[model samples]
Target: MISSANILFEFICFVMALCFLKGNDKFTLFTKLYLGLVCITETSGFLWMMCTNKSNIWIFNIYILFEALYISFGLYHFIKPFKKNVKPLYIATYLIFIAVYLYGSFTRGFFKFQTTAIMVASVLIVFLCLYYYHNLMKSDKIISIRNNLGFWWVAAVLFFYFGSTVYNLFMNVIFSNKPFAYEILVYIMLTLNAILYGIWSYSFICSSRHQKLLTSSY
Candidate 1:
């Protein structure tokens, strides 16, 4: 169960939090909080499993609530400069996600994985990422995405949730019965986690660089 990809994800999240703590990104506070939560949840979930030898599904079910809120709020923050009117949509969607999660918890029970809620959350995040891109392009900005921390952040969300989604859709039918399939799926998820955190870590670095540039200019 312990693997390099898991190690990599944890390492990246830890480092990203460090970068955000010292950096002066406009959203540095939010960045640090989110990354710190990411690390904490991951560590706590692992330790709880090892200590009790119990299923971690319940923990993740709760984690998804915070996950959805944090991501939706973050997107709302990012998109504020472009469209103020659209901000309410994010708030409404976040409330919907919470409602959906509540429904899932009641219907599926805490012990089971709520794939429907997860899929809904994932779909919303992926859609937000696409919406951000569409707005980014519409803005006529000439800057490369590399310098845009928001772009990288959105991209990370896009890739991880989108990749996991395909698995979410057919995993029970295709991979549940096979012996090694679950293990392979776990690794695939780890890789996706790595991608999300790795890009996020770099985005923090980019934010730090820009923060320094602004300070030096002043």
Candidate 2:
């Protein structure tokens, strides 16, 4: 099942964050926290489904709120190094997300999947990822992408959301028209999760090595 693989990946990322990144920086601390929440949410959702044989949409509905906010904050953290006066943009992004989320919740109900809200969020995140890349390219400072945890982390985010855009956009159509739709969707999700968690695990390794080097140099 997707949850089995997803939970394993999330647990690995969470452990790496704790061992290598906890207290390393504000961003990493938050990342660790976020990963912990992800693990818990995924497990809980899985258990809820197994035990109650009911939809866990409400759990994900709540989790998505945290997910969007944390991702926005992460992007803001990365982008702030290159651009000043970005707080307003960050705030504006939250406002837009909240507006959409509330509207979706009202229209679709809290227990529904809220596809429209997620779609809006995915689009916003993709654009923000592009903006971050643009700023990264324009900056004068030389960066070592190999050891840059932020770069790799953002790259994972970019790949997952941007890569999933088409799938997300036509998810209903695919389910309606395609054979083995559930299997196809699961495979897609697994691939996306592998990409995301693989990069994240590597970033944590880079963070650990980078920290060790920093310590040795001091």
Best by TM-score: 2
Candidate 1, residues 1-218, lDDT tens digits: the string is 55445755767776765755364554666666766776677778888888999987787787787788888877887787788798788988788787887898898787878788888888888888888889988986576665677888788888988889867886666545665677677777878887888888777777667667678999
lDDT of 2 by residue, 44-94 (tens): 999999999999989999999889988889999989999998878777887
Assess every candidate by TM-score: 0.89, 0.94
Name the regions of candidate 1 deviating beyond 4 angstroms.
Answer: 1-4, 20-26, 174-176
* Model 1 Cα RMSD, 1 decimal: 2.3
Cα shift from native, residue 145, model 1 (Å) = 2.6
Clashing pairs in 1: none
Q: Rate the local accuracy (lDDT) of all candidates.
A: 0.77, 0.86
